[model samples]
Each structure stands twice: as structure tokens, then as C-alpha cells.
Target: MPAPERIPPGRVSSVDLLAKGELTVRGRVREASNAVLYCSVSYEGEQAHCVYKPVAGERPLWDFPDGTLAQREVAAYELSEATGWGLVPPTVLRDGPYGQGMVQLWIEADPSESLLALVEDEEPGEGWKAVGFAEVGEGRTALLVHADDVRLRRLAVLDAVINNGDRKGGHLLPTADGNLYAIDHGVTFNVDDKLRTLLWGWAGEPLPADASRTLTELAATLTEGAPLATRLAELLTSAEVEALRGRVGVLLGAGVHPLPSGEWPAIPWPPV
Candidate 1:
């Protein structure tokens, strides 16, 4: 395994300084027990929108400190870039008088057409039912009916290999054109049993053809001599890479409809 890519550190420009006067506040995007996310109009002309995440004031149930959380978020973005998956884009981590926060690319919110909305509009079929998760609203089920979709399923597998603990329904955004995008990957790459998530509801199922191909390509990209492999090695240890490889092998062996276990929580709360 090679070293993971290093993200450059910098301070985000002061929002207060930028917003001299008459800056209208956009509607709140999300507010949860751990963090509050807001969309705001930028003072500068270059960027129109920015997403803000304030520091967690109280001690969290999870073990990550503020700095570690910020670093993980940055690392996840870098990995997403390397993998060509729109999991999360580049973000600016900032520390100010208010405390720590992250300024990321603002995703345009559609007219309540997210994946969660789609699930809420339909009834759960034979293999679907709502799980006790915050993001799964009323009438929404967590089961993956199109589990056979190779691209989507493979992305899920990659997520699992990364030990992403937050794969909530809300984090999965469906574009107007029907492409799915993943967001909020703060609780990942930890060396612990904290691999909780809502995906893998269909474990042991056969991998879709396209998913297998993507995984194969991803594995090749992570080989010893590859740039991606070198980048990952810097960010992760040899043991972590071995674990990731093991997860990939398991997913490749499993098909598209394996059952999920009930031991772990369906998703990570306060998704950062």
C-alpha cells in the first residue's frame, strides 16, 4: 500500500468580514443533536454558496476530537477525489472565535426529490421496512430494491471497506437525472468496531457485474506501484489496507441480496 494524499491546510475567509451588511440568511439545511448545517450567501462574488458546520461543544459519544474529525473529513474528501466517486468534494477547514467549522461545496437542494422522499412516497414491499433511524422518515423503508444495480452496489461496498459509519438515507442524494451521490462521511477510517451503517442490508448476495468490474479497477488502482496506492498508504497503515482488501474480497464474493445483521446501529448519528 502507498501513502494517502495530503490535504493542504488553510483558513477559510471570515464570513462575518465578508458579510458586511444585508446578507440574507438562507434556510437551514439540517440541524441535529451534534451539529447544525446552514446554507448561506457568500459575501464574495466568486462563490455563491457555502455550507457551515460548527464545532461540537459538548463531548460526543464518539471518541473523535474536533481536530481529528476535521482531518477525517478532509481525508475523506481526498479519497473521494481519488476514487472518482462524488462522495464528498474539497472543503475548507477553518478555526475561528466561534470554534472549528468546515466550509464545503454547497449542494443544491432539489424540490424534496431526495431518495428519502421517494421512499416516503411509496409503501414498503416484501423485503422493505422502515428501520429505527433518524433519517428514515415516516413511510420510508431502508431496504434496497434495486440492489442489483452494479454501480450503486459497488459504491456501497467501497463505502463499507472504508468503514464509513454513516450511510443514512438522507446522505444519499439522487440528482434530477437519477444519479445517486453520497455525502457526510465524517465517521470513517477509524480502527475500531464502530462500523455501523444502514447499507449492507443485502449482504451475501452476488455482486453485480458492473460493481465487480469497478471493484476490480479500484483494486488495480490501489496496487503497490500505483499512485493511489501510494497515497492511501501515507494516510493509512498497512493493517488498514489489509483490512480494506479483506472487505473488498468479501463484497466480491457476496452477491446482491444478502441480509443485514441487527447487532449494529443502522447509521451514525450527528452525521458530520
Candidate 2:
């Protein structure tokens, strides 16, 4: 990834920069399933790097409605902001050169931060939580584990609330400033129970105190006619919005991390 061009001194907010700036296609992230254009957005000479995913470039998904992935991405960002966790970067839906799509602040992850690991031991040692077992080829198996850090725990709760269908290792972004952000939310907010991810280490565990409180607050904000509810209505179907509310209620009622539903695959293929 190339460094973003520096902007003259300014104080524009990231959301403002993304929503109003002129986008210049700097490059493309070819590894992404959907069209991911790496670009720089400049507003009044204040420039910053961002990712642009045009709705026209989205691929069809049998499970999700067509042309709605970009909206879902923005919806995920809204939910993340409502949680006060800021786990997802600043994202907005706006008209781009290719058409309307999702634009989000581009973050550079720290190369040295190790959040997931595979170990030969049956159980994970200190500072780690075991997810399950994975085949490492040659008929060998290893324990899939993730860090026991609170940041990841909070993200797990957020995932449950949104019913994220793909929480692969690549989506976890940890920066050098001690901030962790998650991305690629196009498959989230489905009405069905499709919470697939590698962060199942906390399954069946009691919800952390902070998480419980946040869920309680989120439930209130998601009630019918509320601001968040109204905003989500624009992005998701009525059924999906209702399901999101029900999910929060369920979390508050259950008071623990949810275990995977056998109805769907517990982990996404190519987990990393």
C-alpha cells in the first residue's frame, strides 16, 4: 500500500472528508471479492486515503438482495458508531465516479500485531482463547486460537448484534495506536442467524460488563421510530431491521456470548 498524499493543514472530520471530497482512484485492492478501489479524497485541500466500493461493481450473492451490499456496509458503520466502540472506521454512502457506493477511512494495520494463531496444544495457554481445531494439511491438526483481549471480545458482541455472516481473520485490523477496527461488512445484518467467524473463542461465555451495558443502550436506540432505526430502515428491509432489534433483545436477555447455530457453517471457508 502506498502512503496517501499529505494534505495542507486542516481540521476536517474524516466523515466530512469522505462525504464531500473529490475522489481520485489511486489503485485497486484486487484481493477483495467486490470492487475495492483504493483512493484519496480531498476536501478544501484536506486529503486522506479511503476505500471506495461502488454499488455497480458488487457481485451477486444468492443469500443477500442484489445491489444492497453497499448500504449494508454503511449500516454496519452506523451500528458500530452507536456502540461507542468505533470498531468500524468512519464510513458513508455517497455518489462516486462509478455511482453510489460505500466509502470508508483507510487504516494502516500494524504488521507486528498478532491477533490470531494456530497452536499444536489441545488447549490455548494464557492470554489466548481457543476457537476450535483446524487441519494444517498433511493430516495434522492445530488449535485455532485468538487473543483474549477485551477489544476482540467487544467486537464479537458487535458481530452478534449485526448477524455478520463473514468475520474472517483478514477483517480484523489492529493499528499501532492501540486501536482495533473491523471491516468488510457487506454480508452483515441478515434476518437469519448467519454469524460465521473465527472469533468464536468466547462462545457461551458470560458477556462482559461493558458489553451488557452497551447492548442495553443499543436496544433503546433501535426501537421503532428512533433515529438509528430510521436510518437502518433506509439500508435494510423491514424484516431485517426488526430482526436486528430482536437480536439485541436476545443478547440482553441471554447475557452471554452466543454459540454457533448448527443450521449454518460455524466458520467461513478460508478462515484467514
Winning model by lDDT: 2
In candidate 2, which residue pairs clash?
none
Model 1: per-residue lDDT, tens digit, 107-193? 544445523312433444443433333345676544333233344564566576677767765666555555565666666676653
lDDT tens digits, residue span 118-198, model 2: 999999999999999999999999999999999999999999999999999999999888999999999999998999999
TM-scores, all models, native as reference: 0.62, 0.97
TM-score for candidate 1 = 0.62
Q: Return the top candidate by TM-score.
A: 2
Q: How far out, in Å, is residue 269 in model 1?
A: 6.2
Q: Return model 2's CA RMSD, one decimal.
A: 1.3
